[model samples]
Target: MFSGLFLLAGLALLLINYVVVNETVPDGTGIVSEVVSGEAGAPPPEMYDQVVPAPRDSGQFTTKVARTAVETFRTSTMRQLLIASGIALVGAAAIAALLGWLTARRALRPVHTITATARRLGAESLDRRINLDGPQDELKELADTFDGMLDRLAAAFEGQRRFVANASHELRTPLAVQRTLIEVAMADPTASPELLRLGQHLLHTNERSERLIEGLLVLARSDQGLVSQGPVRLDEVVASVLRSTGGMAAEQGVTVVSRLEPRLVFGDQVLLERLVTNLVHNALHHNEPGGSVVVEVGDQPALTVTNTGAVVPADVVPGLFEPFRRLDRSRRAGRDGAGLGLSIVRSVTRAHRGVVSAEPNLGGGLRITVHLPGLHRALSPASAPAETLGV
Candidate 1:
C-alpha cells in the first residue's frame, strides 16, 4: 500500500514540475529582454510594437508587482496542495489496511475455533462436541457436521466396549466352571466312579471350550468383513443344521418340525449354516421334555424357531441375543458353554445384512425370527420345499 502511494505521488509531482517549468521559463525570458532593451536606451520605440505604453513606469511597476504576487500565490498554493494530498493519501492507505486485517481475522475466527476443537479430540474423547457460538454461516454448518461425526464415533466406541466386555465375561464362565469341577474331584478320596464322571465332565468342558473358540473366531472374522458373499440355498443350510442337531433334539425329548421353501439368498454359506444351527440348538436346549420345536423357512429366506418351554421374561428379551446374557441361571450354571451362542447367531445374521429378533411365544416358550436378504428378482424360483432337524 505504501509503495503504491509513493508511486502515485511521484507521478503527480513530476507532472506539476513540468507545468510550472513550462509557464515560468517563457515569462522569465520576456522580462530579461525588456530589462536589456531599457538599459541599452534603444529609443524605447514608442510606435515600434504596440500603440499605447505604460506612463512614466508607474503602471509598469504596479503591473510587475501584481504579476509577482499572483505567481508567488500560485507557487505556494501548488506546494500546499501537493503536501495536503500526500498526507491524506498516506493516512487513508494506513487506515484501510488496518481495517482489512481486522475484518479478515473476524471472518476467520470460527475456523480457528473449529481447528482447535478438532485437535483436542481423539478416540478416547470422541464424545466431545464443538460449541458454535458465532453467526449462522458456513462455519456453523461445518461445526454441525463435526458434531454429528462425533456422535457416530461415540456410538461406535460404546458398541465396541460392550462387545469386549461381554466376550470376556462369556469366555471366563466355562473356564471357571471347569476349574471348580476339577477342584471338587480332587478333594474326593473314593473318587472311582465319581472321578470317572469328573473326567467325562472335563471332556465336555473341553468340547464346549473348543466350540466357544471356534464361534469366537467366526464372529471376529465376520466383524472384519472377511467372508465372501454369493447366492446360496437357505433350505440346504437349514437341512444341514437339522441333520446335525437331530440326535441332540431326540435326546432332549424335543420333536423337530420344519416348513421350508426352497429360497435363495446372497450370503456366506458357512456362516448362514452356523446361524441356523445356533438358533435351533438354542431353541431345543431351552425347551422342556415332550416339547415341540417348530422351524419355518420362507421364500424371503426368513427362519422362525419356536420352542415350547418356559416363557421368556419380558425384561430379558431386549438383551437376549447379547453375549453373556442368559435368562435362566440354572440352565447356564452347570453347562460348560460360553453364553455366546445367541450372540454369534445375531452377529452372523447382521454380517449378512439381516436381522434377528426374539419374542415370547403365545403359549409357553420363546420364538426367534431371523430375516435375511434373498436373491435378486432375476433368478428363477425354486420348485421344491425342504425340511430339516429341530436342533
Candidate 2:
C-alpha cells in the first residue's frame, strides 16, 4: 500500500511538470515573432527581420531547438522532484508506522488492565473494581460496565454468605434441644430393652446431627472471612491437636508421628487449630488398625499429614475438599463421618490465606499438604512466651 501511494505521488508530480513545461516555456520562439509582425503600428517586416532572425527551414529547426531546451528543463526538474519525493515518502511511511504502533498500544491499555483485574477478583476479592479513568470512549464504557458487574457480584456473594451464617446460627438452638431430650430419655431407669435401644439410636442420631450443625457453623464462620489476624505458632497448634486427639487415635489403633518445627503464621489461632485437627482426625479415622500417621511442620508454615488407609483412587482426590464428598459410600453408610472434615479443612485454610492439596499414596493411603504464608522472624519456645505465640 505504501508503495502504491509513493508511485501515485511520483506520477502526479511528473504530470504537473509536463503541463508547466508546455505552458511556461514557448514551443516555438520564431512563430511568436512572426505572429506579432502584422500587428497595427507594429514595426515593418524588414525592421523585425533585422531585430529577430528570419524564420529558417520553415521554422522546424527553431521548434526542434525550443523543444530540446524544454525537454532538458523538464528532465532535470523531474529528477530533483523524484529524489525529494522518494525521501519524503520513506520518512512519511516510517512515521506512520511508528504512530500506528503507539496508537494501538495506547488503545489496548485498558484491556490489559481489565484482564489483570479479572484475574485478581475471586470469592474473597470481589470488592475490587476497575475504576478506569479516561474520555467517554468505547474502552472507558467497557470498563464502566465491568465495574458495575463486579458490584453486583460482590453484593450477591455478600448476601449468600450472610444467609448461610444466619441459617447455621439459627439451627443450633433446636439441635441442642433435641440432644437434651434424647439424653434424658436414655437416662430413664424403667425403660425396656427395645425402648432403650431406640433411645440409644436416637441419641446417636442426635449426636450426629449436632456434629453436622457444628461443622456447618464452622464452615459459615470461616467463609465469612477472617476476623482475627494474629501470629499463630503452627507447631504448637499441631501439638495441642495431637494431645486432644490422642485417646481417639489410640482407640483406632493408629500411631501418630510428628516432625514439628517452630513455624509461625498470621491468622486466627482457633481456625488454624481446627484446620490441623481436621486433617489429623481425617488421617486417623480413615486408617487401618496398624497404620501410622505422619505430621510434618516446616519453615514454609506448612503442615502435611499422611496416613495409611484403604486404597483411594487418584481421580477422587480432587473432590475430597468439596462439601459432603466422601470417598466410599460404605463409609457413609457405616456412620463413620459427616463428610465435612476435609471441606472444613479447605475452608479454614482459605480463610487463613493458605493453600491445601491432597494426593493418593502409592500403596494405600493419602497425603494432604497445607501451605500458609510464613512470618519472617523465626519463632521458638525460648524466644517468646507461650500465650504471645498463640500456643
Candidate 3:
C-alpha cells in the first residue's frame, strides 16, 4: 500500500511539471529584432534598406534559454520531492506496523485469559470462570459461553459427590446391623458347627463391606476438598503410621526400615495420616516373606515407600492408583485388601496439593513417591520427641 501511494505521488508531480513547462514555454512563429543606424547625424543610407535583416530572429534563442531554465528547475524540484516522499513513506509504514502490533495484542488479551482459565479448570476447580469485563463483542461472548459451561459442569460434579456421600452414609447402618447379628449367632452355645462357620463367613463379608464403605466415604470427602489445614509434621505422621501398622508388618514378616527427616507442611492432619498409612500398608501387604520395606521422609519428595515383592510390570503401575485396580497375582493369596489403598493415597495427596507416583523396581517390588510443598522452617527432630513401636 505504501509503495502504491508513493508511486501515485511521483506520477502527480511529473504531470504537474509537464503542464507547467508547457505553459511557460510557448510555441509560435515570432522573431526578435534590433534596429541600428550608421550614424546619428547622417542621413539614411541610400544603398539598400536601412534595417540589417532584423538580427537573424533572436526570439528562438531567447525561447531556448527559457526552456532550459524551466527544465532545470523542474528536475531539481522533482528530485528533492521524491527523496522526501520516500523517507516519509518508510517512516509512516514503520509507525503503522508498530501501532498495529500493539493493538492486536490488546485485542487478544481476553483470549490469553481464557487459555489460562482453561488450563486451570479440573474436576475440583470447576467453579472457576472467565468473568471478562468489557463491551459485548465476539471475545466477550466467547468468555461468557465458557463460564456458563463451567457452571453446568460444577453443578453436575456437586450432585455426583452428594450422591456418593449419601449412599455411603446410608449403607453404614445396615452393615453394622449385619455384623452384630452374625456375632450374636456365632456366640450362641446351641449353634451347630456348620451354623457357626456360616456365621463367621457372614461376619467376615460384612466387615469387608464396612471397610469398602469407609474407603468410599474418605475418597468422596477428600474429593470435596480440605475442611481445615494447619502445619503438619510429615515425619511425625510417618512415625504414627508405622506404629499403627507395625504388628501387621511383623505378621507378614516384612522388615520395616525408615530414615525420617523433619519436614513440615500445611494440610489436614487426618488426611495426611491416612495417606501415609495407606502407602505403608500397601508396601507391607504385597511383600514376600522376610523381605524389607524402606520408608524415607525428606523435603522435596516428602515421602517414599519401597518394598520387596514379586516383579511388577511397568505398564501396570499406573492403573494401580485407580479405584479397585489390582495387579494380576501380585497380592498374597490369603490376604484381604479392598484395593483402594493407592486410590485413596492419590486422592488425599491431590487434596493436599501434592503429587504421587509409582514405579516398578528393577530387581523386584515397587517404589512409590509423594511430593508435597514444605514450610520454610520447621521443628527439628531433636526438639520434637521421636516415637517408636515394637515390630
Candidate 4:
C-alpha cells in the first residue's frame, strides 16, 4: 500500500514544466533598407543589407514559436491526494496490528484456562473443568481431553483412598481381639514367668502394629489434601504436643526445649496437631540420653524443629521424608517406629499448600522447617516473647 501511494504521489507532482505555442507573422513583402554608418577600415559594405525586391504573394508568412511553462503541483489537488494517501497507509497498518493482537488473544484463551486448571489439580482437588465452549477446533479438543483425564484421575484416587480407609478399619477388629486374648491368657493363675514374659512381648508387638496402621490411615488422608481449613494457633499446638509427649520424652531420656511464639496458620486442626506430635516424637525417639530437642515457631517458617543426636549426614537428609525410611544409625539403635513420621509431615505440609524442608544441622541431627501460608499476616515470632519451656 505504501509503495503504491508513493508512486501515485510522484506521478501527481510530475506535471508539465513548459508549454510551446506557435504564432503566424506576415512575411517581409517589401524590402526595407537600413544602412549603418560605416566604421573606419571595416568591410562593412559587404556585410550590410541591400534593398531588395518585394514578395509576390502577400499570404506568405513566417511562423514564430513561443515556449511557456504550466504549473500544476502548486494547486490543492496534489496536497489533498498526498494527505489521503498518507492517512490510508497509516490507517491500514493500525487496523492490521489491532486485528492480529485480538486474534492471538482469542486463540490462546483456552490454553491459558487449561494451564491454570492443571496447576490447581491434586489427589483430592481434581474437580475443576476447562469446559471450553467454541467451534470444534483444535484448542477446544485439547481442553476437552484435559478435562476427561482429570475426571479419570479423580475417580482412581478416590477409589484408592476408600480401599485404604476400609482396609484399615477392618483390620482394627482383629487387633482388638488379639489384644483381648493375650491379656486373658496372661491373667491365667498358673502362668509361668516365661509365658508372662512372652505375653508381654507379644502385647508390645501388637501395639506397634496398631500404631503402624494408624499412621498409614493418617498418611493416606494427608495425601488427599486438606478437607477443612481454619486459623489455628501454632504455638499452642506445639505446646500441647510437647506436654502430651512429655512422658515419652522422659522415657527416652530426651529433654524438650520449646520457644513458642503465637503464630496463626490455616489448616485442619487435627492434622496440625499430628504434625507437631510426629515431629516431637521423632526427635525424642532418635535421640540418646542427655540429648536435647529445640522447637521454635518463627517468622519465615511457621514451625521449626531441631534436635541433637548422632550426626546426620547432609547427603542423607532427603531420604528421611520417604515412608518406611530411617537412617542406618537410627535403625541400628533399635528405635521403635514405622518410619512414617517425616513422611506424614511432608504430606500434611503439601496438603496445606506449604513447603517442608529438612537440613542437616551443623553439629548433629536435622533441622526441619515448615513454611506454611497463614490466614493473616502475624508479627514475627522472633520479636514476640518466647515462652521457653522444658518438657
- lDDT by residue (201-268, candidate 2, tens digit) is 88787778878878887887788677667888888888889878888888888888788878889988
Off by over 4 Å in 2: 1-94, 112-125, 220-228, 332-335, 351-353, 381-391
The TM-score, computed over Cα atoms with residue i paired to residue i, of candidate 3 is 0.73
Q: Measured by TM-score, how close is model 4 to the native structure?
A: 0.73
Model 1 TM-score is: 0.51
lDDT of 1 by residue, 1-391 (tens): 5456555766687578657755664342354345435652432242223212435556555445434544555566667766776777677667766776688788888888888889876544565788788678898999989889889877986777677558767876777777677767766787788676777778666667767776776666555432367888887788778878899988998889888777788878888888888888888878899899988888553888888998777778878777877877667544526777788888888777788888898788888888888875554465445444433
Give the runs in model 3 whose Cα sits over 4 Å from its true position: 1-86, 115-129, 329-336, 381-391
In candidate 3, what are the lDDT values of residues 1-391, reduced to their tens digit?
5445545666676567656765654332111111112222332243123223324466455444434444555566666766775676567666766776688789999999999999987676787899999999999999999999999888988897879768876899889888888888889999999999899878777877787888888888788777678999899889878977889887888888888888999989999998998898888878888888889888789999999898999989999999988886565423547788899999999988899999999888999999998899847645334333324
TM-score of each: 0.51, 0.70, 0.73, 0.73
Which residue pairs clash in candidate 1?
A: 242-389
Off by over 4 Å in 1: 1-195, 332-336, 377-391
RMSD of 3: 9.9
